[model samples]
Target: MPDIFFNFLACPLGSYCPLATLNRNTGICEPYSYQLPPGQPSHTCGGANIWSDVRSSSEVFCSAGSYCPTNTEKNHCSSGNYCPTGSTAEKRCFKLTSCNPNTASQNIHAYGAMLIAALATLLLIIYNCSDQIITVRERRLARSREAAAKVVKEKIQARARWKTAKEAAKKHAVELQGQFSRKFSRKRNITVSDKVTVLNEEYTDTDGNSYPSHEHSTSLVSKKSQSASEVEEIGSSPLMKMINEIEEQTFDSSESFSLEIKERNLKTKKAKGKAIHTHSQIFKYAYAQLEREKAQQQQNNNLTFSGVISMATNTDYKKRLVIEIGFTDLTVTLKGKKKHLLRSVNGKIMPGRITSVMGPSGAGKTTLLSALAGKTVGCTISGSILINGKSEPIRSYRKIVGFVPQDDIVHGNLTVEENLWFSARCRLSADLQKQDKVLIVERVIDFLGLQSVRGSLVGTVEKRGISGGQRKRVNVGLELVMEPSLLFLDEPTSGLDSSSSQLLLRALRREALEGVNICMVVHQPR
Candidate 1:
């Protein structure tokens, strides 16, 4: 009988099985739920057994805050490690994780917090670096534009010099040619008369004796032919020779200069057909446009009134909306003091014209402008204001209106171009293209003669920058860049010299020619 052996299986390593019974149906142990009591066969069986898998309440696994490595062994979780219930081995905590002794699980909140802090720091660094990069790029572009503008100015000067030299040479040549013709004709006449006299004297004169007329005539003819040959050898007169030399030099220079200009223009046209990706190309286009405008202005200066009207009618420029402002019995009075600032003033500001309001100190010029612009405060205005020959509030067309104050209202810290650009960006139509906006700003800069100081700061009281006259122009430029249809200016030329005042007026005149209604007050006109 092989010793009649009987084998009893023990519990697994990770589970406890005391007081177990075999189930005949399932062929497995039943009620293997309690651990063996220490130092006794069976005491109270207080705690549940440790097991990898538990199916019923009686077969509960190990509790939390402890780990079980074997059926009969359990240990509290160690430091730097965490253990869940029924864990066979402790898990080491990750970096920045909190795992105290006897802890159930690792705490990874510190890692999450560190990750958030690092992300925030990275974002801040990116923001600052991006801003610095943008600033540096803008500064480089500004320097490039200024250099290009300087080159354009030099080219303009060269063209002017060439034109002047050409004109002077032409005038001097004409004068010299006239003088040489007169001198040569006088010499020829004297020689011809002497020959005729010698030939015609065949008979004796009143006091002449019998003489050899043929011999005298032959000798005189020989002398006359010799003098004529001598005159022919002399070529042109000395003055005429100098004039010819100068004309040749000037003509050659002018031709070369013209050729250069033509080549540049061709290059510009070619560049225009393609995309302008460089600052130099952009400035070249601007220079070409400026040259065209100069030519147009010269033509306009020589045009009669009818010719100007016809030319203006034939231009391709899109007409802006006309704004004609008329006021009837306009009266403004102080609210509290009952003092009349404007007493029943009547006037109309028409499109395509400049209306100047001149008065001494204490006059109501500024007050009237403010009232017309619908910016009057603390005053009672009683009148009817008409817009486009209809009774409409001036504020209705505020978007198309502009008003320049007596004082220069401009940003002191920003450059002149920057100031104008800001105004144009804010006030120009949202649908306008970026190139068009740039053109408007540049046009204002050129018209106001602010190119030299475009990049210079407007300056504050603390730090001086451009002159007062330049600042005044910049102030007006702010409004001009917006392409307003109705403009009101208060003392725009007050602090400027005669030339600056004339320049401002000329710019305004150009605006007026574009169908803008302009009304300005001036203390003194130049």
Candidate 2:
């Protein structure tokens, strides 16, 4: 029955047909399990037939470098193509790939190289485009700043001219009024004396004072001449001459008049819409407002010594939060050693004041600041640090604390504005408005006198940039932009000239007015 079944049956592709004899004991085909016997002699093995692992035929299986479409057929791979054992079709080789006829596989080194080239090209394009974009943005910002500065200068000049003209006109009007009053009085006196002569009597005044006499008349004429000479002298003075010249030029020059008119129109537009969109416009608006405020303060005499004394004495002016740091018996000892970094340091830093820590080299000024700021490392601190007269860890208010190291720990690649802006964004309150943040950054830049160098790079040793003094101020500005409640500085004025140091101190003094608790280490007492 198995032979009859095998006579009509044929093996499919990937398999082979073979002759087999029946096994009488097991009732199965001989030399193979679960295979039926072939009835005809023509049915001989040509390829692999048995599919069972127990009776596999390696000699009849498909060979390498070739494939079998049928169990009894085989084909060679064509040129520029590759094929592995049992492949039904050849594969075309990749470009630059090595593939000979009847090859088993194509080399992939060319594909890897192409992939690497593509990736490198992509990276190069990205880098170049990014650099170009940054350069363009910086240029635009610089131009904007220059335009703003120019506008501010023009506005200030126009204001000064107007003020000078007003003052000169007022002086001239006063002189004319004085001369008119004197002439009228003289005529009236002469008329009264004529009337007295006609009546043949003398005019007497209260307290037995006589009427206008010859000596009085002569004195009055002399005073008139002197005042006229004084007026002539003032008109010939350099200041008056300059004022007159400026007025003449302003009125005579069409270009100057047109420019002034344009400025007025721009101001009117600004006031009507408040459409200050660009950086230059914003800067111009802000500066104009600031100037107006300054002028108002000057006119009001708000910055007088008496006003300052009153502001200092008034408790209501201290509205911001005050942080007072008082340390008693502060001692910092090195771990596992008896040596002390700071011994018995007793002092307090008050709010709304600048406390200077002064000492010679290695006198532990930095150490004391570090200890107060809670930045001491690898040391055992033993002391009572009181915050607002209460014992508390400095870390509790670390969010409001700022520490500036002696080293200029700033990004050399970043501009002064960028460094300060990054610090402000990261350190300021998360909910702060962008306008407020911009205001803070601009204020810091203006106070530090970094306006000129705001767009310039902070610079590295390899690439020279702003001066060392400006860089140092930028370093301080980083912390100032954060509006810290308690600020600590280490050698902030170290390497600064006298003028730069004074500027820095003035900025710090302004901060102190805002109730910031400031403590800094200074090498020079002056």
Per-model clash counts, in order, read 0, 0
Stretches of candidate 1 above 4 Å error? 1-77, 82-91, 96-98, 102-135, 150-274, 333-340
lDDT of 2 by residue, 1-526 (tens): 3334433445545432345566667756644455444576554323223343213434344455665677657777777888765566677887788888878889888889999999999999989899899889988877876687688879899999987877787577557556755765775676566555533433443235655566655665675576667657756767666556655664677467435534654675556365556777766665665455345346335567766775566564465578998899999999978789998889889998999988889999999999999999899899899999999999999888999999998999998989998999899989865545666787788778887788798899999999999989999999998888899999999899999998899789878877899999987987
Estimate the TM-score of every prediction: 0.62, 0.62
TM-score of candidate 2 against the unseen true structure: 0.62
Give the alpha carbon lDDT tens digit for every residue of 54-105 in model 1. 3433234454666778766677888999877667678889987889988878
Model 1 local distance difference test score:
0.78
Q: After superposition, how far is residue 161 of candidate 2 from its true place, in Å?
A: 3.0
Q: Report lDDT (Cα) of residue 23, candidate 2.
A: 64
Which ten residues in a row are the worst by lDDT in model 2? Answer: 45-54
Candidate 2: stretches off by over 4 Å: 1-122, 201-277, 289-302, 309-320
* Candidate 1 colliding pairs: none
